[model samples]
Target chain A: MGDEVSSNQQEPEMSQLKPDPIGRTALAVEITNRLRQMILEGVMQPGEKINEKALTTQFGVSRTPLREALKVLAAEGLLELIPHRGAVITRQSEAEIAEVFHVLAALEGLAGELTAQVASDAELAQITAMTEELRQSYAQTDRPRYFRINQAIHQEILAASGNDTLVKSHELLAHRVQRARYQANLTPQRWRAAVEEHEAIAKALAARDAETTSRLMRDHLLQKLTSIRVKS
Target chain B: MGDEVSSNQQEPEMSQLKPDPIGRTALAVEITNRLRQMILEGVMQPGEKINEKALTTQFGVSRTPLREALKVLAAEGLLELIPHRGAVITRQSEAEIAEVFHVLAALEGLAGELTAQVASDAELAQITAMTEELRQSYAQTDRPRYFRINQAIHQEILAASGNDTLVKSHELLAHRVQRARYQANLTPQRWRAAVEEHEAIAKALAARDAETTSRLMRDHLLQKLTSIRVKS
Candidate 1:
C-alpha cells in the first residue's frame, strides 16, 4: 500500500538479488511493480507499444525476465499483448470505464461491509490517521499529495476488509482505468464532499453496521465515478 | 461464462476476415484463449514448465506471438512466469483460496445488486428457466449437470448486471478458484440446502428486491465458504 515512489523504478538494477530460493519471484515482482508505476504515472501512455528488446536492455535483464514482468503487468490489466504488435499499454473505452466504476462500487461496498464486520481498533486508528492526512493535503491544495493520501485511505479500507481477491481485482480494474485521475482535479466542493463521505465511512465502521457501511461505500465510489470524466 | 471447454478448432474454414481487419490484437487473444483452456483443463499442470520454442511449434506461431500469448495468460493469474523458470500454472494456498472466495462473495453481491436494479422480465425469465433446469438436475441427482446449470444461473445474473468489469473479474476469479468439484462433493443433505438457497436467490431476483437479492447473494456465498472443506 505504499505510494507510487516504491513503484517508480524505470530501469531497475538486476545486478543485485535477494538471498532466497524465491528470489526470482521477488525480482519478477519488482519489475511488475515498477512497470505498474510507470503506466500509472503516464510515463507509459495507454496503447503505447512495449518494445521487449528495449525493455530487456533498459532493465539489464534478458528476454526471459522481461517477458515474465510483462506477463505480470498484463494480468494486472495495465498492459495488453497484441500478437505481432507485441505488448501494449491497456486503454479503456468510455464504456469500459463505466463498467469499472460499477464494479468498484460493488467492491468498495463489500469492503465497507467487511470493515464494519471486523475492523479492529488499530485498523480504525490507521484509517483515522489517513483521513487526517487527507485533510491536511486538501488544506494545502496539493493535488498529487492529496491524491496519494486519498488513495491510501481507499486502499486501507480494502485491506482492512481482509479480502485479498477483492484488493487485487480492485487494483486491477483501477489500473485498467489509469486510475481515472478523477480525484486529481478535485474541486474544493467535491473535496469537502469527499471528506464528509470519509467521515461517514469511519463512523459506519465504528458502529459496525454492515448494511449502512456497505451502502455508504457504494455511494462513496459512485460519487467518484460521477465526478471523473472518462477520457475519449 | 460457459464451462471452460477445450476449443475443438475444427470449425469449417470461414472467410479470411470479417468486416474489420484481423487485427494484431485478435491473434494475441486467440492464442491466449487456447492457452487458457489448456491450463484450466489441467493439460498444463501447476509448476509445469512452458517452453517458448515448443509452444511456437505447437501454436504454429513465431516466438514473438508465443511470447505475447504467455504474457496474456500471465496477466490472467493462471500462469506464473519466473525469470529463468519461464511460465508455469498458478497454484493457490488455502489462505489465498479463502481470499479469493471473499472477493468473489463481494463481486457476486454487486452482481446481485445490479441484477435487482436492471434485470428485466426477460432476464428474470431466463434465470427462472435455469432454475427449472437446476431443479430437474437436482431431482435426477446428477451433480455435474446441476453444477453446470448452477454456474449458468450465476453467470446470467452477472451478465444481466450489464457491467463488463464485474463480469470479467468475476469470471476470472471463478476460473482461478474452480470450486465446482469441491461443491460437487457436498453431502446430499447439504446439497439440498444449497439448492434451497439457490431457489431463494432466484425468487429474490424475480421479486426485484435489491436488498433481498444482495443479502441472499452474500449469504449464499458465505454459506459455501463455511460448508466447504477448502482444502489446504
Candidate 2:
C-alpha cells in the first residue's frame, strides 16, 4: 500500500496541487476533496489501510494536514480510524448500502418532483438531450461514457430542483455509495430496463407530471440497487 | 427578571436533561444534542451572542467540550462563529425557512408513503390514537400538550418508515427548523385546519393510500410553513 503511493502519483493533475500559505485548514480541505475523489474513483479501495506517508509526499503536505483530512472523512463515515492500524476505508455492509440507497431514493424523488415543477425549459431540454446521449453511450458499449452521462442526468435533476441543501444532502449519500453505483454491472436485460427507466424519468419530468416523476425517480434508484447488489 | 438572555436553567419538565459522559468526544456530542435542544426550545435566541460562561456553568463542563459542541452546531448552520465575538445562533431567513421546510416536506412525504406501505397494524392504531389525543388537547385548549402530541405524531410516522437513515436525514433538517415549526403561532382557524390535516393523514395512512398519504404529508408541512412565516 505504501509502495503504491510512493511509486505512482494518484492524480494526473497533482502538478497543480500546491499547498497554499492560507494555513493548514484550507490545505486540509483541499486534501479532503482529493481523497474523496480517490475513494469515489476507486483509487483507494475499501478496507485498505491509508498510506499516510505516500499521501503526504504526493500532496507535498505535512502529516498534520493529511491526518486532519482523514479525520474529516472519518466523521463522514467514509474512513475508519483504528487504534493501532491508523485509517482504514470503512467497508460498508449490505445493510449500510441499503440504508443509504433508501434515503437517496427519497431525496432524488424530491429532486424529480421539484424539477418537474420548476426546471427551466432550457434545463428540461438539456436533460432530454442528456438522456439521449446516455442511450447512445449504452449503444456504443462505452461503459465509462455511459457512467458519466448517467451521473450528469442525476446531477441535472438535483440542480434543477433549485435546492442547494437538498442537493448537498443527496450528494453526501451519493458519495458514500458512489463506487458501488458506478461499478454496478447489470445483466443485458437489467441494463435495457435501466436505460428505459432513465428515458421515462426524462419524459415524465418533461411532461411536468410531478407525481409520476417522483415515483419514477424513486423506483429507478431501487431498481439500480438490484444491479449494485448483483455486482457485489 | 435579570437581563440574562439564556438564564433559563430549564424547569422540571426536562428531567432527562443532564448528560454526564465518560469521554470528551461523547461529552461534546451530548452537549451538541443538549445545545440543539436549547436552540429548538428557544432557550438560545437566534442572532443572540452565546454566553460562554453561562453555558459552561450550566452544562457543568469545561470550555473545551462546550466550544467543541459549539463548533458542531456552527457546522450544522444553527450557529455562527464570529471572530473575537463568540457564537451567535444563526437567524434563519424567511428564505432559509422555506427551503428547509420544502425539503422536510419531501422527507416526511417519503415517510408517509413508506409507513403506509410497511407500518404495523399496532403502529397505525397508535398513530390514529395520537391523532385523537391531539384533537383532545386542542379541545382542552392546552397548547403545550397539543405541541408535544403533535411532535409525537410526526416522530411516530418517521419511526414507522422503518428506515433509520431516512429518519436521521429528516431529523437533521427538522432540527434546523424545529423552533420555527413549534413557535408558529397559528390563527384559531388555522390550528383547527392543522388538526384536520393530521386526521386526514392518519386516515389515508391507515387506508394504505401511499400517494394520498405522501401528498397530504407534503401539503400539511407546506401549510405549516405559512404559519411559521406569519409568526416570523
Candidate 3:
C-alpha cells in the first residue's frame, strides 16, 4: 500500500523539463500533493515520522527530493519537520482545527461572492447537476460518492469565481484542515443537515445574489465547524 | 557569511519543551523559524541549493536533524526540494507578484474590519506612533526606516484584530509574496503618496469607523498594487 501510494506520485513533469534546472519547486509541488492525499486519505496517521529513508526508497528518489517534498507538505500544514530530528506529519489540536475553519469561512465567503458575481449559465447548471448527484448518492448510502459530489459542488463554485488566487488560497486552507473523517463520521442527521446547507448555497448562487450566496456559504462552513468542534 | 548566519540562529531552548513526550513538533518549529529568517533576510536567495551535507556540517548536526529542518523550511515556502536533486529557494514571477497583491488586498481589508471593531486604546496609539515614524522616515527619504515603520503599523492592526489565525494567514501571504524590491523601487514621490494613504487608515481607525477603515485599507493595498504594476 505504501509503495503504491508513493510510486503514483512520481515527480511532476516540470521537474525534468529542464536539464538540471531549478527542479526543487517541481519536487516540492510533487511532494505537497502526495502528502496532502496521504493525510486526507488516512494512509499515514497524523503525526507519523514520515520516515525520510523509507520515503526516499518508496518514492524511488534520494533524501534530497524527499526532504524537499516534506518541506512542501509542511507549508500546507500537513507535515511538520524538526530542526535536528527530521519531518513528521502534523496533527491539529481542537483549537487549531477551529482556527482552520475560521479561515475557511473567510476564504469560502470570498469565493462565494466572486462566484455569484461571475457564474455563467453553464456553471449554474453544473452546480445544479452536482447537487442532484449528491442527493442521489446520499439516498444510496454511498458515503464516498456523496462526499465526492459534495466536493465537486464546492469546487465548481470556486472555479467559477474567475479568481485563480482566491481558489489557490482556499485550496491551501482546505488541505491544512484536512477533512479526513469529516463526512465519514457524520451521523445520518448531520448528513441531512449538511445537504440542506449545500442546497441553501446553490439556491443563493442560482439567484445571482452575491450577498445571500456569500452569507449562505459562510454559514455552511461555520455550521460544519460547529459540528466538528462539538464532536472534537 | 553562511557561518555567521547559522551561528546567530542557534536557539538552544527549543530542546527544553517537548509538548508531546514522543512527538517532535517543537523541533520542527525551531527549524522552521531559522529557515524562515534566512529566507526573509535574503541570506538565502531564491533557487539556491540547500545542500544537506553542507548544512549538517555547519550546524554540527547529522543528516536526520538537518533533513527535518529542511522539511520545515520547505513547508514555509522558503525551499523547494527536487526528487533527485535537492532543495532550493522559490522564485516569484511578475504575474505571481500581482496575484499576491490581489489576495493581500482582500486579507488586509478583512484585517481592517476586525481591527476597527476591536482596537484598544493602546493599540490605536501604537498605530498612530508608527504612522508618525513613517512620516518622519518619508521626509528623510529613508526607505528602509520607512518600511520598518510601515510594517509595524500593519502588524499593529493585525494584532489588534485579536485573531491569531488571521494574523498567521496574513503572515503566510506576506512571506509568499516576498517582493521587498517592489516597494523599495518606488519613486520617492510615490512613497510619499503611500504614506498619505497610511494617514487615511490611521484616521479612520482613530474615529473607530469600521466601514471607512476597511474601505480605506483595501484602497491602500490596491493603490500599492497599482503603483507596483505600473512600475513593473
Judging by TM-score, tell me the better candidate of 2 and 3: 2
**Local lDDT at B79 for model 1:** 78
Worst 10 residues of 3 chain B by lDDT: B1-10
State the interface C-alpha RMSD of candidate 1: 13.0
- Model 1 lDDT per residue over A147-192, tens place: 7788888899999988777787888887776556542456678889
Indicate the residue-level lDDT of A205 in model 3.
Answer: 86
Q: What is the TM-score of chain B alone in each candidate?
A: 0.83, 0.83, 0.82
The single-chain TM-score for chain B of candidate 2 is: 0.83
> In order, what are the TM-scores of chain A for the candidates?
0.81, 0.84, 0.83
Compute the lDDT for candidate 2: 0.82
State each model's CA lDDT, in order. 0.75, 0.82, 0.73
Interface RMSD of each: 13.0, 17.7, 14.2
Please provide, for model 3 over A1-72, each residue's C-alpha lDDT reduced to its tens digit, 9 standing for 90 to 100.
Answer: 223433444454355455355534455457657767877877876656667787777777677756656666
User: Per-residue lDDT for B195 in model 1?
Assistant: 88
Sort the predicted structures by TM-score, highest score first.
2, 1, 3
DockQ, per-model, please? Answer: 0.32, 0.13, 0.21
TM-score of decoy 3: 0.70
Q: Which portion of correct inter-chain contacts appears in model 3?
A: 0.23
Q: Distance from true position, residue A49, model 1, in Å? A: 5.7
TM-score of each: 0.78, 0.78, 0.70
